[model samples]
Target chain A: MLNFAPTQEQEEIRQLAQSLAMEQVRPQGRSAEQQGDISPALMKTLTQTGLTTPFPEEYGGSGVVEAVTYTLIAEELGFGDGALAMNIIGSLMGPLTVLLAGDKSQQQHYITPFSDASRGHLQRGSLGFAERTGGYYVTEISATIRTEGEQYILNGSKRDVIHGGQSSPRVVLVRLEGTSGTGGLCALMVPLDIAGARVSLDEGKLGLIAAPSAAYTFENAPVSATCMLGQPGGSGVLRAAALYNILRAGVACGTARAALDYAMDYARGRIAFGRPIVSYQGIAFMVAEMAMKLDAARLLTWRAATSWDRGTGCETLVQEGEAAQYQAIKIAKSATIDAIQILGGAGFIQDHPAEMWMRNAAAME
Target chain B: MIDFTLSELQQAARDYAHQVALEEMRPISLECDRTEKIPDSFMWNMQRRFWAGAAGQARTQAQEGEEKQDNILSILSQEEMAWGDAALSTAIPGPGLAAPPILSQGTPEQQAKFLGPYMDGQLHWGALALTEPGIGSDVAGMSTTAVLEGDEWVLNGHKHYITNGARSDLVVTFATIDKSLGREGIRPFVVPRGTPGFVVGRIEEKMGLRASQTAELIFENCRIPKDHLLSGRESSKKAGFKAAMGTLDATRPMVGALAVGIARAAHEKTCQWVQEELPKGFSVYKRREIELELDEMGQELEMARFLVWRAAWMADRRIPNSKEASMCKAYAGGLVMKVTSAGVRISAPGENSESRQFLQKWFRDAKVFDIFEGTAQIQRLVIARRLFPEVDIP
Candidate 1:
C-alpha cells in the first residue's frame, strides 16, 4: 500500500542480521579474503539467526516465510559482506528445491535437519548450476539428465559451484535428453559421497572471495526417482531461473547499499586539491549517480521478491525476477566500481573493502 | 523512531498540493515557459495554498513542542508545485532567496521593517544580492564595498544571477567595508530597490528556467539609513559569512525536494507513455525492461525525497544540518538531471517527439536546480568540510 515502513518482525530481523554482519560477517569476510577460506564462524552466526532453517513449521522453521522478508534478510546479509552473503544464500537455495517441491518424507529427512538444532551442526546443502563452459545462464547449461528404469543418471561436470568440493548433497541442474518444454530440464539431489561422483582439488576462486568454490564431476551418478522434486516429470528451467534471479538480486542490492554508505562516509572525510574531493562537481555528481543506481537496484530487488511471494503465475514471477536480476547486476557492478573511483588510489588497495566488493560484483553470478 | 512512511496528515497535505499542481499549474506550464513570465493569479493561488499548508494556525493546529513541520511541509509543497511547473514554483509570491539571510542576520527592527513588506498585503518580493560576475559560490571573495559616513552607509557592488533582484521591494546587499578584512568586514544591508544609484543591470539570457528572472544588480553609491544595517550580535557579526551560509541549512532541502518532484514528473509521464503508447512490436522482454526502468526512477525519486525530508526535519528541529542539507542537495540535484534525461530517451526514442520536447525542457530546468543555491559541487564541499573539520587541508 505504498509504504516503505517494514513490519515489526522484518525490522527486528533486519537489526539482528545487521548486528551479525557488523560484528561478525564483515570482519570475517575481510580477514578470510586473504586466505580464500570461508569462516565457519560466520556460517554459525548465520545459522544462529534461524534463517538457514528450511521453510517448514513442523521442522521448526518460522514456516513458509514471506519471500519479501527473505529478500530483505538477504540484502542485510549482503550489506555485511557480498561473498559471504552469496555463500549463505546459495546454501539456503540448494535445499529450497526440496522445501518447495519435495514430498513429506523428503522434507523430514533432508530439510528437517537444518531446522532442528538438536540434530547437531547445520548440514550444508550446495546448489550447483554453473558449468565449465558457456556462460552463467542456467538455460544454456551443458549437463545432461537421462532416464533408465527406476533411476536417473546424471552426466557431465559443473565448474565454479559454491561449496562444490565440500561433502554435501548438491542440487544439480541438467538438460533432459529427448524432452520438450516443461519436461526439458531437470533438477536432481545428488549426494557427492556416492560412487561415480568426484570432487576436484579446490580451485579457491579469486572472485567472490567470501564463497570458496571448486569444480566437481558427475559420471552417470544414479539418483532414485524419489529424489527428484515436483511431479515425477516436471519443469525446472523457469522455476530455477526465477529463484536464482530473486536470490542474486537480493545479494546485489545489499552490496550496492553497503558501497553507497561507505562512499558517503569516505566522501565526508577525504580531502583532496585543497578541499574535500567530494566538493568537486564531477565527483559529487558521480556519487549522486551511484546513490541513484543503488537505490534503483534495491527497489527492483524488493519488487521481484514481492512478485515471487504474491504472483499466482510462473510467467509473471519469472519476468519480474529476470528483470530484477538484470538491474541488480548492473547496479552492483557500477556502484562498486563508482565506489572505488570515489575512494581513488585507496580503493585499489586491500585496506578498504571496495576492491574486494568490486571483484565480487564483477562476477555477478 | 526511524521510518520512511508519511503521517496521515502529511499525506493529505501532499495529496492536496499534488492536485493543485496537476490541475492548476500543469495546464499553464508550457505557456509560462514560452512567454518567460508566470501569470500573476497563478502565483497568488500558490501562495495561499502554501500559507495554508503550515505557515500559521490555518488548515491545521499545532501542539506545543510537537513538530509543526512547517519547513518540511513547505519543501514538500515546493515539490508538488515544481511537478506542475518548476518555473511557476519559483514564481510563487514570497521572499525568494532573501528571506533566509535576513531572517537570521537582520536585527529585530531590520527584520520587521524589511520582511513585513513581502509577507503582508500586496505580495511584494525581496532578493539576496551575493553572487558577483567574477565570484561564484565564494562568499568571502565578494568585491562589493560599503562605507559608513555620518549616519548613512554608501554601498557599491554588482550582484549577478540574483533572483528577483530587478523587481523586489528590497535587495539584501552584502558588501565589505574593507577589502583586506575579506569575510570579516562583510555586512548585509537592506537596499530598497528604487534607492538612488541602485540600477537593474542586464537580465540573463538562458537555456532553461527562462520563466524565472535572473537579474544582474548594480549598486553605485546607493545610500541607506543606519537603521537598515543588519547588525545582530557580536558573535553573529563575527560569524557573518558563516551565518549567511547557515541560511542554506533551512532552504537547500526545499530545493532538493523540488528537484525530486521534477524527476518524478518526468518519470511518471514516461511510464504512462510506455504503457499507453507502446511502440509497434514492443516485445514482452522490452516491456519488462521499461518497467524496470520505471522502477529505477521511482526508487531514485523516493531516495532523494527521504534525504530532503530528513534534512528538512533537522532544520525544523533546529539541529545542525549543514552536512545533511548539502548531501540532500547534491543527491537530488544530480539525479534529477539523469532521471529527466532518461525520460526523454524513453518517451522520444526517435530523437525528436512532442513528448521528448516536454522532457527535454524538464531536463534543462533540472540543471539549474544543481547549479544554484550553491552548486552540487559546493554542497559536496560543505559536507566534506564537516567530515574533516579537524583536517586543515592546504
Candidate 2:
C-alpha cells in the first residue's frame, strides 16, 4: 500500500483544476491583486465550477466533501494565482463550518444558499478563527460565547478573518463563558448584519491582496442559541479546524509549485556567459532546491489530506494537518524568494509575478 | 492511492537496524570518534551477525524468485542504523560504495571475484574511488590515467577522501584511457588489495564521522589484468562514466537517508533536553518560541524523510530517478545541517554531558552530507539539467 500514484479520478480532477488554474485563474492573479478584489466575471466562472460549493448535495452543493479532493482543487487554484486561490478558498470557511458543525436547520439556512448556482458567488462565508495571540493553535482560542436564555452573547475580537468584511454568515470560534482551553471550545454562525458586531477591512497587507481580509470585533452580539455550530463538547469544530489547515497547506503547495515553474522558465531563457543561466550550477541548484522543497511540501499536504478523507483518528488528522501547513508555508516562503532571486531585477518589478508571489507566500506564513 | 505505510519486511528491517543501533552503535559511538577508528572486533561481529546474514538472505531470496526491494530496504535500514550513530553505521563491514558499480556493470567473473568474499562472513570492505587530490565534482576532468600494456592495465593517480579506502579488499577505480576523450575515455578498473604500488596514503583527520576512515589512495604504476575491467573492452566507451553517475544516482538517496537519520537523532535528543532541562515556570512567550522551533524541526525532518523515501521507492520500481535522487540529496543535505545546528543551539546551557557531546559531534558530522556524494550545488545542476533537457548544461 506504499503507493504514490493518484487514483484515476483524482488525477483527472487534478488535470481539470490545473487547466482552470493555468488558463483562467493564473492570468487574472495580478489584476485581481492590483484591484484588491477578484473580478465579478471571474468569480462567476469559478463559482459555476462548483469549486466554492463543496457542501452536501441536499444542501445545493456537488457534495464533494472529501478532504483530498478539496486539497487537490485548492492546490490547483493556488497554482493559478495565490490571491485568487485564497479568495476562492477563503470564501468557503464559513459554510464549511456550518456544514460540519451545524444542525440540519442551520445547514438549510446557511449552506443551502451557497448551492444556489445563480447567486452562490455573492453568498460568501468567512471563518473568524484566528486571534491576535500566541499562534494558530486552536487551544489559543480566546473569544468567548455565553448562553443567555434562548440566545448566545458573543464577545471577542478576531484577527485574520478572511473575507470578514464582505461575507455574511460568519462562523466564529469561541470558548464558552467562564471556561478555558480546548475543553470549552465551540463555534457559532452569526450574521454579519447583527447589532454590536463591527467588521474593519484590513489595509496595506503585504500579500493576498485580491483575497482581502478583515478584523472583527464583537461587543455582546447576541444571536439565537440555534446558531451554535455543534454541541459544546462535540468534535465537529475540531474536524473543521483540521480541514482548514489542510486546505491552506494545499494552497501553499500550489503557490510554491507555481513559483518553481516560473523560476525554471526564466532561468532557462535568461542568457549570461553565453548560455542560459540555468546551465550554471549556481542558478540551476537554486531552482532544483526549490523544486525539491515544493515536492516535499506537496507530498506532506497530500498525505494529510488523504488521512483526513480516510477518517483516520483525530490525533493523526491534527498532527499531519499541522505538519503539512508548517512545511507548506515554509516552502512557499523560500520558493518564492528563490523565484525572485532567479529573476534578478525583473523579480523586484511588478512587471513580473515573482515579487507578488513572494509577498503572498509571506502572507500565507 | 498514495500511501506511506511500510510493508512488513520493511518494518522488520527498520526495527532490527534500530535495535542494533541502540545496543551496538551507541555504546561505541563516542569512543570510536575519540579513537578515530571502529574496533576490528566490532566490525567482525557486525559482519557475522548482521551484514552477512542480510546479504546471504537477499541472495537466497533472489534465487527463490522473490522480488528485489533492495533500494527501499537499504534506505530504511540505513536510516535506522544512522539514527544510532552515522559514523559507526557507515563503518559496518560490507561492500559500502563498491557494490553498485560492480553489481550493475561488472562481468560475472568480476562479480564472483570482488563480491564473493563479502558473503563469506568475513570483515571485508569495498570502496569506490572517484574523487582525487585536485578534482571533485568535475568527474570528466580527473587526471587519473589507465594505459593498456598487453593483457594488463597500468593505473597511476591519487584518489583521496575515499570512504573505507584504506581497508577495502577491492576498489572500483576510475581512470581515463585517453586524456583528450574526457568522460568517454574513463574506465573502471578493479584494483585488488596488495597490488604492487597501490598504497593507502594518508588517513585523514576529520571534523566528524571519525569512526569511518577517509583514506587517500595512491596508484603508482598499479597494475591489474584487463579481465578486471568492468563491462570489458567491447562495451560502450561511455559505460564507465555512465556507471559512475549511475552509482551516484543509486547512492545519493541512501546518503540522504543517512543525513535524515543524523538529523532525527539530534532532533530527538533536543526534544528530550527540552522536556527535562527547561526550568519550571518558563516565560510563556519563550516557551511558545521553543515550541514553534521544535515544531519546525519535526516538520522539516518528516519532509526530508518523505523525500528520501520517495526517491528510494522510485529507484526500487526502476523508474528513471536521477532528478528525484538529487532532489532528496540536496534537500536532506541542507536540512541535516540546519537541524543539527539548531539542535546545538536549542540544547545549549546544559552540562557537557554525553548527550551534549553527541549533539556537538552530530553537528560536525552533518556538514559533509552537503559536501560529499554530490555537493548541494552539484545536485542542483543535475536537477536543472533534467528540468531543462532542451538546454545543454556542460
Candidate 3:
C-alpha cells in the first residue's frame, strides 16, 4: 500500500527543467551576477512554458502540475545558479497562491497576462514578503496598508525582494492598518507601473548576484479591493504558509544536487599522488555523506509534496513541514558548505560556482 | 519494483496477531503492564492458543504440507504470543526465545527431539545463548569453547544475558568448535536441561521486560552427542559465527517488531488519554506538545513498520537479506527508542496525563531492542561494512 511513484509527466518536466537550467541558466547566470540584475530574458522563457503558471486552465494556467514538479524545476535551477533559480521559483509563488484560492475574475486579471502564449513570454511576477529587519520569521511585515472604501493603500517597503522591480506584475504581502502581527497581513497584486512603488537596488551581494536583491518603497500605493488574495480579514495569511515551506524545500534540494555535481566532478578530475582525489577516503567519504543526505532529502521532499497533492490528512502536515522545509534547508546549507570544502582554494574564487552556491544557500537560509 | 503490500501470508500473520491482541491480551495489557508479571495460567492459555504448552497438548493438528512443523513449532508464534505482554510473550516456552537459531542451523533430528517438548504441552524453556560477558556486539570474539571428545562434543565456556536461560529446558549454546578458522569454527549445540556441566549461573535483575528470565549460563564440560550440533554441514568455527549472525539477521526484525508492539501500546494509550483526559484551558501549549509528539511518534512508527515488513518480507521470500535486514533493524530499533522516550516525556506528571501506566517500562524495554539484537552501533557497522567494503567501518 506504499507505492509512491511519480507519473511520467512529472519526470518529463523535471528533465526539461534540469536540461534548460544547465544549458541556458547556468551560463547566463554569471552575467546576470555581474550586471547586478536577475535576467528578465530567463524569467520570460519560464513563463512562456507555463512553468510559472502550474495551476489549472480555468485559472489562466495549466492545472496539470503539482507542487512537486515546481520544486523539481526549482531544485535544478538552484543547482545551475542559486540566485537565478530563486528568482524563477520565487516568481511562481504569486501564480501558485492565486491559483490555490483566488476568485476566477481575479485569476483572469492577474494570471492571464503571463500565461498568454501570444505575449511572446512575459516576465512572470515575483513574491515580495521578506523585509530588512526580520531575519527568518515572517511574522513582522513593515509594509502598511490602509483601507479607504474599496481600496487599500500600501505605504511601507519590502527589502531584499528577489527580482523586485524587474518582474512586470508582482504580489506584495502587506499588513493592513488596525491589525498586528501576521494576522493582519494580506497579499495584494502590485503592478510595477504604479508611480508610488520605487525600487532601490542593493549592490554587490555576497552570492546569487544573478538574483536582484533590493529595497523597495511603496508610499501610498493604491490597490483595488479585488486584488486582495484569500479571505481578506480572516485566516488568509495563515492558510498560505504551506506554500513557502514546500517551495523553499524544493530550492534547497535543487541547489544541493548542483553542489554534489560540482564536487563529484572535481573529485573525479583532480588527481594527487598519482590518483584522483576521489581515491582518497577523506574525499570519498564526504562525497558519500553528501550523496546520502541528498538521497534522504529527495525522499523527504517528495514525501512532503506528495502528501500535499494527495490531501492525505492533518497528521501529514507537521511531517511535511519538517521534511520539506527544515530538513531541506539544513541539507542545502550543509551540502553547499561541503561542496566548497571539497574544492579547497579553487572554490573560494569568483570563477567557480562553488562560492556562489555557498552564498546562495546562505540566502536560502 | 518491490511489492510493498502486506501479502496474504503477512496479512494472515497480522490477522492472527490482531485477533489475539484484541480478544485475549488487550483486556489485561494494562494490568499485566502495571503488575509486571503474567501468571502461569494466563501463559498456559496462550500456550493453548499456540505452541509451548505445559503437558504435551499440541495447539493445532498438522497443517497442509506437513513435512514436519518443527520450524513453525520452534518459532515463538511471535505474532500471536506478542499479544499478551511481549515481555511475558518471551517468557513462554517452545516458540518464545529458543527457536530462532534452532530453526536456522539445527539439524533435522535435533529440531524434532530438542524442540519437541514445548509443542507437546511439556513446559520446556528454551534460550538462545550467544552474547558473552565481554562480547555483546562482537559475536566473533566469543571466548566459549567446544572441544571434540570421542563421539561427544564437550562445551566449556559461559554465555551472558540469555533470555529465559534460568528456566529454559533446552539451551542452544553457540561455541567455538575450531579456533583456527575463527568465525567458521563456531557452531551451536543443543544442551538439554540438567546436563552435568551446564548451569544457569545467575539471573540479572533487569529494568524492564521484567517477567522474562535473563540469566548468565555457564558450561563446564557439558557433553552432548556429536549429533547435537545444529549445523549439519560440519564447517569451520568461522562458518558457525556466520550462521549465528545470519539467524540474527532474520530474528532482529522480529525484535524490532516486538519494539513496535510495545511502542504501539504506548502510542495508542497516549492518544486516547490526551483526547479524553485533558481539561479546558489547561495550557494549549502543553496540548500542542502532546499533539506534536504523537504526530512524530506516529510517523516514526509507520516508517519503522515499513522497515520491519521489508526485512521480514525479504526473508519470507527467501532473498539474501543481510543488508535490508540490517537497515530495518537499525531504523526500527532507533525509532522505538525515540517513540518510547517521547511517550514518557509527554504522558508523565499531569492531571490529564495519559502515559501514567506503561511509558516508563516501555522506555526501559526500548533500550533492550537497541542493545540486544546487535547494538545500534553494531548494525551501523554492518551497514557501513556492506555499503563501503573498502572503507574501514568507523
Candidate 4:
C-alpha cells in the first residue's frame, strides 16, 4: 500500500489551499511584510476556509485535527508567502497544544474561541516553547514552574513567542521546581493578561515581518492549577513540541517550492547569449537541484505528518518530525539562495519575490 | 493516501538481502577491496542464489497477478546488499546495467538473445557502454562509429569506465553512424563479448569499490548482425538519446540506493563506535554537539532514502520520472559524500578496528556515487531540462 496519491478529499483541500495561495496570499506577501501584519481581509479569507479552526466539534471547530490536512494547508499558504503563512498556521500553536495536552475543561476554555468564525482570524494563539539561552533539544529548556497551593507559579522568559503580545491564552514549557532535564518538564497555559506577566512585541527581525512575535517575561505569574497541560512530568509537552516542528517543516517545504517555481519561470523567460538562460546548464542545473531538494523536503514533511496522524509513539514522532524540520529548513535556505542566484542582479532587489523568499527563508531557519 | 510501508514481498526481499549482505558479503568485503577482485566461486554461488530467489519472485508475481514491483524490489535489495559492501554488491553476477535498455528498447528477439542467459542460473554480466575516454556527460558528441556493411553493423570505438565491461557476456555499445547528425545518428548495438575485435583493455585501479571491475572496452572493427540494433529500426532523431536517457532514468535511483546503503553503513558504524568506545569523560557539551551531528546524518540518510524510493516507485508505476530519477541520484550522490565524510570525522580519535578501517573505505567508495551513472552536475542538467521543457537544453 505504498501509495503517493492523496485521497479525493485531501486533493480537493489541496486545490482549495493552492487557489487561495496563488489568488490571495501571494499577492499580499510584499504588502504584509511592509506593513508588518497580514491584511484583515486576507485573514478573514483564511479563517473562512476552516483551516485555522482544527479542534473538537463541541469546541467550535471542524473537529478534524488531522496533521496531514494541516500540513497540506500550511504548505500551500507557505507557498503564497512564508510570513503570512506563519501568521495563519502559527495561530494553531496555542489551541493545538491545549487540544493535545490540556484536560477536557481546558480544551473547552482555550479552543472554543478559535471556532468563533467572525473573530477567528483575529484570534491568534501562541506557543512559548523557544528560549533565548537553550538549544532546540527539550533538555536545554531552563524555564521553571512551581505549584503553590491551588495555583502554579511560573517564572521564565520566552523569546520568539509567536503572537505573544496578543491577549489570547498561550502555552509555555517550564521545568518543574527542583527538577532538571526532560523528566521535570511541564506545559502551563498562561493568559497573557494575567498578573506578573509582561509581553513586549519584538521591534525588529531579519525576516518573517508579517507575523510579529513578542517576548514574554513571567515573574511569579500565578495560574490556576487547572491550567496545567497534561501532568507535570508527562510527554504531552514533548508531543506538542514535535508537532510544532512538523508543521513548520510543512511551511518550509512550501516556501522552498515557491522559490523554485519562481526561479524556474524566470530562467525560462530570461534569455542570454542568444538563448533562454534555462538552456544553459549553469542556470538550469541550479533550478533542477532546487526542485529536487524541495521535493525531498516536502516528502519528508508529508511522511512525518502521516506518522503523527497514525498515532505513532512519541519518540518516533519527535525523531521523524524533527528530522523533517531539519531538512526542510536547509532546503528553504538553499532554494532561496539558488533562486536569487538564478535571477542575478534582478534577484537582489524587491521587484521579484525571490529576494523576499531569501529573507523569509533565513528568518525561518 | 501517501504511505511509506513496503509490501510484504518487498519487506521479505529486503530482509533476505540484509542476511546475504551480512553473511556472504561482509566477510569477504575487505579482502576483495584489497585484492581488487571478487572470487569467481563467490560470484557463482551468489548468482545461483539470486536467480533462485528471482525466479521464485517472478513466479509469485505472475501467479498473483501483481503489478510489476521489480524497481522497488531492486532498490530495496540493493540498499541492503550495498550496506554490506558496495563493491561486492555491484560485482554480483546478473544483467547489471544493460537490462533496462534491452528490456525497454530492444526487439523481442534481441531481448531473448541478449538477456535469456541471465535466467539460466549461471554467472553472467551485461553492460551498457556509453561513456568514452574523451566524453562522459556529452553523450551526443561521442566519436564511436557504427557503419553498415551488408547485413552487419561495424563498430569502432573505445568505451571506458564501463562496469562489468570486461566480464559481461554482452555489452550494449553506443556508436554514431554520422557525427554530423549529433544525437540523431547515434545507435546502440548488442556486441557479444567474443565478437571479433571487441577488446577488454586495462582494468582500472580505483580509490574504492575496487572489487567492481571498471574496464576500457575497445570495439575495433567489431561487427554484429544488423538485427543486433536495439528496436531493429533506423535511428530516429530522439530514439538513441531517449533510449540512453531512459536507461539512466530507470537505473539512477538504484544507484542512489547503493549510495544510501553505503552512507547508512558508515553512519551506523560511527554511531556504534561513539556509543561503545568514546571516552566516558567526554564533556556533555561536546557529546551534545556530536549527537546533533549524528542527528543530521540520520536525517539526511532518511531524506536520501525517501528520494530513492519515490523515484523507484514512480518507475514501477510507469510514470514519466526522468526528473525524479535525476533528483534522487543527485541528492543521494551529494548526501553520501557528506555523511561518509562526517562518519570519518566523528569516528576519529577512536580505536583503529576493522570496522573503523571500513569507514575509510566507504568514504573512498562514496565519491563515485556522485560521479557515475551521471555526475551530480549532469543530473542537475537533466532535472533542469525537465523542469523547463521549453528551454531546450542540449
Candidate 5:
C-alpha cells in the first residue's frame, strides 16, 4: 500500500489533539514549566482525555492499539507542553511494560491499577532506563538484581527518573548479577512504597522543568519472585526497553514539529530589508531545511510506531527503535537551532515559545 | 490507511528489477565506468525487458485487478536498477528524463507529437533542458527566451549540464517569452535536434557515473513551430515555474530511489564484508560493535526508502506532495552520502578490499545525487515554500 495518510481513527484523534492543544494544553505549558511540577488539574485533564492511560479494552482503558495514534497524541500534547506531555504520557512506561510482556498476575496488579482514573484515582508512574553513571551505556546499567531463595534483591540507584519522587509504581532495569550484556538485563516491577526504597527530593536540571524528575535508591530491597515481568529471563525487558526508545523518539518529534511550526509562523510575518524575512533565501532555506528534517523525523517515528503496534517481534522493535531514535535526536537539535535562528533576536527571549522548545528538546537525548 | 506494504505486483517488479540489476547491470558497470561509455546492448536489452514486464503487468492488471501501486513500484524499480549501477538506470534508452514534464503538463496532442519519437517503438532519448549556466534552481530567472514570429517561435537560450543531452533527439526546453513576467513568462517547448541554431556543446567529464555523459546545449535563435509550446499557449509567470516544479515533484522521488540504490549497494557490501570477510579472531565486543553499526546502517537505508516510497505514492495518487517530494530528496541525498562513506570505511582491509574499491567508486557516484534535480539546499527551499506559503519566495 505504501500510504502515509492516517487512518480515519488516527485522523479523528489528531484533530481532537489539535483542538485540545490549542485550547487546553498549550496555554498552561509556560506556567507548568515555571512551577516545576504538573498541577493536579492538568493531570486530570490529560487523564480524562484517555491519553494518560490508553490501553486495551479489557485493561479498563481506551483500546488504542496503534502506536501511530499514540505518537500523534504525544506530539500534540508535547506541542502543548513537553513537560506535561511527559508527565502524563511518560507515566505509561510501567503499564506499557506490563502489557508488552508481563504475566497475567503482574498485569492484574500493575496494569489494572492504571485504569484507576475512570475508577476515581489519579496516580502516575515512571520507568527508569537511564542511570547517571558517567560514560556508561544502557547495556552497562549499574543497578543490579540478585536472586536469593524466592526473593530477588534489588540494589543500586536510578537517576533522572521521571516522577521519581512520586508515590507510584515503576520498573527499573537491573543487571542480573553473574551475567553480562543484554542477556543479563532484567526488568522488575517495584511498588513505590516498597520497604528499603528511598526517593530523593525532586532534582532540578536542564530543560523539561515542568515534569518532576529525580533519582531513586533501593537498599537491599527484596521482592517476591512474582514481581519479575514476562517469563524467566530476557523477555519483557527487551520489549520494554525498545518501547521506551520509541516513546522518546515520538516525544522528541513532538518538540521538533512544534518548534518548526512556530518558526515558520514567525518567518511569514517578520519583515527585513523591505519584505518578509521568509522571502530571503537565507531565511527561506533555513525554514525549508527545518521542514525537511522534521518530515524525515516524523517518518522515522511513524515507521517505528507502526512496527511497535504490530507487536511482530523483538527484532522488529529493535530495528525500528534504532531507526527512530537517531533521527529523533538529530532532528530535535537541528530544529531547535533553526527555530531559534529563524526568530533571530526575538527567539532568544522567553516571550516566544521557541526558547522553551529549545529547553525541552535538550532533555530528549 | 498508513500502510507501508507494497502490493503483490510491486513486489514482483522489485524482484525482477533486482535480478536485472544484479545480473545485466553489475557485470558491465565497472567496464562502462572505466570506458566512460554507455553499454548500449546492455541498456537496451534491460530497458526492453523492464518495459515488457511493465506493459504485461499493465495489460493484465487493468481488467478486474484489485489495486495497483504504480508510483511506488516505479520508485522501487528505479532503486533496484540503481543498486547494480547508478548509470544503468539513467542511461537506459528511454524517455525517462523527459516524460515527467510531458506527463505532468503537456496537452494530449503535444504529448503525442513531442513524445512520439521515444514512445513509438523507437530507441531514443528525450531530455528536459532547464538548468542553464547562469540559472540553476532559479528556472524563472533564465536568460533563455522565445519570441513568437507569426506561426514560428524563435527560441534563444543556452543550457548546460543536461543529462542525455548530447544525443537526445527531442528536448523539452524551458524558455521565457518575457523575463519580466518572471515565472509566468517561462514555458516549455519541444525542440528537435535538427532545429536550426540548436547545437550540442562539449560533453562533461565526471568524477563518477562516467558511463552517463552530460552535454552542454546551445540554442541561438533556434526556431520551431509556435505549436511546439508545451502547454499550447504562452505561459503566465506562474505556469512555467509550476510546470518545472511539478516535474521535479514527480521525478525527485525516483532520484531519491536512485540514491537508495547507491546506499543499498554500499550497505550490502559493508554487511557482506563484516559477515563473511571480517576476521573470525575478533573479540565478542568488537563483533558486537560491528553488529550494532550494521544494524544502524540497515535502519537508515530502510527509513530513507520509506520516505521515497511515500513521496512516490503521493505523486501517483495526485496528492499535493511538494513538501514530501523535497523531503525525500533532501533526506535521501544526505543519507546516501553517509551510507557510502560508511561503506568505504568498513569495507576496507577485508578480503583484499575488493568491495572497498567499488565502494569508493560508489561514494564518488553518490555525491551527485544531492547535487542534481535540485541540490539539497534547493530542495529544502522548495519544502520551505510549501511549509510557509504566506510569503512569496523567489
Candidate 6:
C-alpha cells in the first residue's frame, strides 16, 4: 500500500535538474549573491524546462507530478543556489493556486500564458496576504473590502509580498463587508495595471534578495464582479492560506537540501589535524544529525505533497501542511547552522556560501 | 562526510530482515522466549527459510556515494528483528559476534572460509571468544595462550560469558601469542567446530539474551592450521591484538543498537500500556513521569542512534570509526540499562504485568550491552585516550 519509490520519469527529471544545477546554477552562486540578482538566463532556462508548468498537459503543462519528484528537483536546484531557486520557484505558487481553484476559462486565460511560450502573455502574480500585524502569524485580516452593487472596492496594505512589482499580475485577500476576520476575507485577482494598485519593491531583505520581498498597497482599488475567485466571501482567503502552506513547505525543503549539501562538502574536504574534518567524531556526529533531520523533513514534505496529490480534504491536510512546513523550517534552520559549524570560522564570512545559506535558513525560522 | 541514507543494498537488508521478522520470527517470538530455548528444528527451519532467502538475494544495486551500506536501515532492521527476538536476530547466520573482523580485516580467503559458510546458511552458530574470567575489560591481562609449533598454532585459553559459545560451529578464539608484548601479543584464531583440544564449558545462566547460548569455552593446546591465524603476519607479533580490538570497533555499535531496540520496546510497551489503561479524561500522574522519562530517553536514543549510524556509516565508507563506535556503545549501553529498568519501574506493582510481556527480559537483556563489547569503563578509557592523547603517560 505504501510505494515510496520514485518513478522512472521522476528520476529522469531529477537527474536532469541535478545536471542543470551543477552546470548552470552552482558556478554562478557566488555571482548571484554578489550581484543581488539570480542570473535571468538561468531563470529563463528553468522556465523553458516547464518548471513554470509542471501540471496536467490539458492545462498547458506536463501531467500531474508527484511531490517527491518536485522535491527532488527543488533539492537539486537548492543544492546549487537556494537564493536563485527561491526567486524562480517562489513565483510559481500563484499560478499553481489558480490551477487549483480557478474556473476553466480562468486557467486558459491566466494560467496557460505562463506555460506556452508562443502565446507571449506576460503574466506575473504574487499572493498578498501577510499584513503588518504585531506578530508573524497571518491569522488576522486587517485589510478591508467594500462591495458595491456591480463592483467591489478594496482598500488595505499587504506587507512582505514577494515580487511585488508593477510588472506582475496581483492577487489580494481583503476582508469583505459581511465577513469579519477569517470568515470575512475574500480573494480578488487584479492586474498590476489596475487603478489605485500601488506596487513597492523592497530593496533589502535579510535573505532571498534575488526575489524582492516588497509591500503592496491597494487604495480603494476597483475590482470587477467576476474578479473574485472561489466564493465571494471567505473561500479566497482560505485558498491563499492553503497555497502559502504548500509554497512554504517547498521553500523549507529547498533551503534544507542546500544547507545539507554545503555542509557535507565542507566536511569532506576541509582538513583539520591532518585529515578531513569529517574524520573527527565531533564533526562526523553533526553530519549524521544533518542527514537524519534532512531525511525526516523530506519525508514529511513528501507526505504532505502526497496528501494534496490525492485530493485530501482541507481539514485533513491543514495539520499535515503545518507539520511539513514546520519541519522544513526547523530542518533548514538547524542544517544551515550546522553547515556553518562544519566550516568553523570560514563559514562566518560572506565570501563563503554557508553564511548566506545560514541567513536564508534563519529568515525561514 | 558520511551520509546515512538507505542504499539499495541496505534497503534489501531491511526488507529481508523485516520479512523474516514478520513471517518467521514474529510468529514464534513469544513461544521461543517462553520456552527459553530455540529448538534445533526451528533454528534450522530459519536457516533454510529466512537466512537462505536473505543470503541469496542479489547484491547488485545503485551505489549512491561513499556511504555504501545503510547503517540506519540495518539498525532499523535490527530493531524490527529484535521486535521479533533480539537473541534470534543476533543468532541469525550473518555475522553473529565473530564475523566483524572477517568483514573488516579478513583476507579474501578468510572471508570465503569463515563468512561464506555463514552467508550460505551452511553454518548457524559462531562466537567471538574474547573475554576471559579474569580479564573483563583488559585484553592485555588475558591468560589465554597460543604458541607457534612448527606449522600448527597450539592454543590454550578459557573464554567465559561467550554468547552462542556452546553451539558455535566456528569460534574466533583469542590468545596471547607473545606474553612479553602485553596487549600487542594477542591473536585471534578460527578454531573449527570439532577441534580436539577445545572444550565446551558450562553455559552461564543469564538474565537476558536467553535464546542465544552463553557458555564457558576452554581451550587446552587446541591446535589448528597456521592459516587460521586471522590478520597475523609473519613479521609482526602485534597483529593479533590489533585484530581483536578492531573487532570491537565494528561490533560495538551493532551491540549498542540492540540496546536501542530494547529501549524502544520498553518505551513502546509503556506507551501501549498507557493507551490501554488510562481513562479518557483521567490523566495518570505516573504517565506524566513516564512521559518525562520517555522524553529524556528519546533524546538519549536519538543521540545513541546518531552515534551508531555514524560508526556503521563510517565502516560502510571504509573509514575508521573506533572512537565513534566506542562512544555509541558507552552511551547507549548505559541508556538501555537505565531505560529498561525505568520501564520496569514505570509499570510497578499492580499496574502492569512484566511476566506477560518481555519487559522484564528486556530489563535483563540491557545489562549485557554495557558489560560486553568493551565495558562502559573501557569505552570511557578509549574516549579519554582519543580525546587527550597526552593522557596516557609512557
Give the best candidate by DockQ.
4
**Which ten residues in a row are the worst by lDDT in model 3 chain B?**
B67-76
lDDT of 3 by residue, B35-56 (tens): 6566777666666665433223
- Tell me which of candidates 1 and 6 scores higher on TM-score: 1
Which whole-number lDDT from 0 to 100 does residue B373 have in model 2?
91
Where is model 5 more than 4 Å wrong at Cα?
A117-121, A133-146, A155-157, A175-186, A192-198, A218-220, A234-237, A272-274, B58-68, B113-122, B147-151, B193-197, B220-226, B232-238, B271-300, B342-352
The runs of at least 3 residues in candidate 1 whose Cα sits more than 4 Å from the true structure, single-residue gaps closed, are A1-37, A45-80, A92-121, A125-206, A212-332, A338-355, B52-65, B102-121, B147-153, B225-238, B274-299, B342-357, B390-394
In the predicted model 2, the residue pairs found to clash are A285-B380
lDDT tens readout by residue for model 6, A1-365: 12334678777887888888889987887787667766666766776777556657786776654455676677677767677666555566566556555667766666666766654224455666567662223345677778778888877787766655632345666677655544665666766567997877777678766656667777888888787766655343454455465556666676777776677677777776677776666766565556555654665556566666555665545545555666667778888888888888988997678888777666653
Q: What does candidate 4's lDDT look like per residue over B233-253, in tens digits?
A: 344677777788888899999
